[model samples]
Target: MKNHIVTAFRLTIVMLAVVGIYLLIVYGGSKILPTKGNAEIITQNGQKFYANIGQEFKSEKYFHGRPSSVNYNAAGSGGSNKGPSNQEYLEIVQKRIDTLKMEHPGMENTKVPVELVTASGSGLDPDISEEGALYQVKKIAEVRHLSEEKLKELIKNQAEKPFLGILGPSKVNVLKLNIALDQLK
Candidate 1:
């Protein structure tokens, strides 16, 4: 019994030390990042926006990010957890596809980008695939009265290339892109 008690005490101490080390490593790594582990915030027209989190942009003039299962609630970031074969999930995705077609008119025959219709695994993805952003170009151009070519150019400029130019696909941070869009005269 005494040996077991000592073993348990030693295990507890070791675990505490390990956890402390892990926390220090995470905190130190954050300091090296651009935002220092803090949320990236952007101010536009005096309105503050958290650029790191998913934001709801329902306006036709702005590009939409991935759908949030938690309704953009940072406190509860998560996915819908519905598989592709889930009937209810299918309904939801279909509805989103219908809405996209209605909003983008000429895109009725075009394949809607999957990311645009489905919530990401985290449901708080702030970046969208390049195709996702391009998919909405027509609608945004029409609503904002900007030329499609100009909007495409803006997307190209705002796109973040893959890490090391060989990892992951090129993606556009929706918040950053929209901010640039608003800046356009």
Candidate 2:
């Protein structure tokens, strides 16, 4: 009987310690880096999506991100659930291409980034391929009234390298690049 009571006490202590540690991590980290929403993000974010768009959008000097999602309520980000070869996907990509052409009137079709035409698997991707960054250089330079050389420099500086130098392709953090673009603007 005494052993049983002692075991119960030990279990309760362990559970409490774990719960306390979790709470501490949550609260302490949030305090250290407060997450807040701002202009630009039509929808708000929570803990789930680590990419912060609110801050990125507030700046206008950077190249804009891809608009590959259509969330009716922004409940949560999910893919269009369409395969690459789906007719619906083809139609969507065509529309996006049209929009891009209109926005960057002088840009050639070949210059459009693949990411700009294709929706990400998650549809809520916060990054784009490095090609996407290069594709936007001219447009960003024109919009911000900055030189192409300067914009390209920013893109190169803000872009992240491949994981371990070739495990994967290089990527650009859309949010970070946009923020940098804003600063340049």
Candidate 3:
């Protein structure tokens, strides 16, 4: 009985030490990050916005990001929790598809990118796939009176390539892209 108690006590002390070390390492690591573990704040047109969090863009002139299940509420990040075949989810997606088609008339024949119609798992994804950004070029060019080729070039410039050139899919940060668009003369 005494030996068992001693072993348990030692185990507890070792676990505590391990946990403390892990926490220290994490805290130290955060300090080296660009934002220092804080949100990446971007100031645009005299207004500050969190670049890391998704923002709702309703205007036809701006490129839209992924759909947010929580409506871009940072305080309540979550998905819709509906399966692919859920009736309500399907209806929501259909509405998005219809809206996209209406907004971009000639795109009826082109397949809509899935990210534009579906909310991300975190409900706060600020980035959209490159294909998603390109999908809206026509409508944005029409509303903003810019050339589609220019907009396409902007997208190509803003796209972040896959890590190490071979890992993840290429994506564009919508907020950054819109800011760049505004900067275009």
Candidate 4:
């Protein structure tokens, strides 16, 4: 019994040391990031917006982000907590799909990008997959009276590449894209 107690005590010390070192490393890493790992904020037209957090954009002139389970409230960031098989979740997704179809007639018969209809694991996702942005190009171009090619080019320029070229998929920041769109005219 004494030997077991000593072994457990030693293990506890080692575990504590490991966790401490990890915390120190993480803190050091944050010190080197642009925002010091804090929220990236942007000021436009006297209004401050947290660029890292998703905002609702229902205007036809703007690009929309993922569905927000918490209505884009930063304090309540979370998924819907419903499985794909849940009837309520399915109904919500179906309604979103129907809305998209009605809004973008050009998207007829096209498979809507999954990200556009689904709430992200963190409902506050401010970015969308590259393909998701492309899917909306036609509708935006038609509404804004801009060429589709120009919109596509903007998307290409604004796309954030995958981390280290292989860690994640490419995505477009919707806020940045919409800001640029406003400046295009």
Name the candidate that leads on lDDT: 3
- Estimate the TM-score of every prediction: 0.90, 0.63, 0.86, 0.89
- Candidate 3 worst ten-residue window by lDDT: 160-169
Question: Which regions in candidate 4 have their CA more than 4 angstroms from the true location?
Answer: 1-11, 29-36
Question: Tens digits of per-residue lDDT for model 2 on 110-180?
Answer: 66777777756555566777778777677667777889898778878977786547766777777767656
Question: How accurate locally, in lDDT, is each candidate?
Answer: 0.92, 0.66, 0.93, 0.91
Which run of 10 residues does model 2 get worst, by summed lDDT? 34-43
Candidate 3, 83-174: lDDT as tens digits: 98899999999999999898888999999999999999999999998899999999999998999999999999999888668978998989
Model 1, 106: alpha-carbon shift in Å? 1.3
Model 4 agreement with the true structure over 35-139: per-residue lDDT tens digits? 788988888899899889998998988899998999999997899899999999999999999998898887878999999999999899999998889889999
Give the clash total for candidate 4: 0
- Candidate 3, residue 109: the lDDT equals 95
What residue runs in model 3 are displaced by over 4 Å at the alpha carbon? Answer: 1-7, 17-37
Better of 2 and 3 by TM-score: 3
In model 4, the worst 10-residue window by lDDT is: 30-39
Candidate 2 lDDT score relative to the true structure: 0.66
Angstrom error of the Cα, residue 91, model 2: value is: 1.0
Scored against the true structure, residue 26 in model 1 reaches a CA lDDT of 94
Total clashing residue pairs per candidate?
A: 0, 4, 0, 0
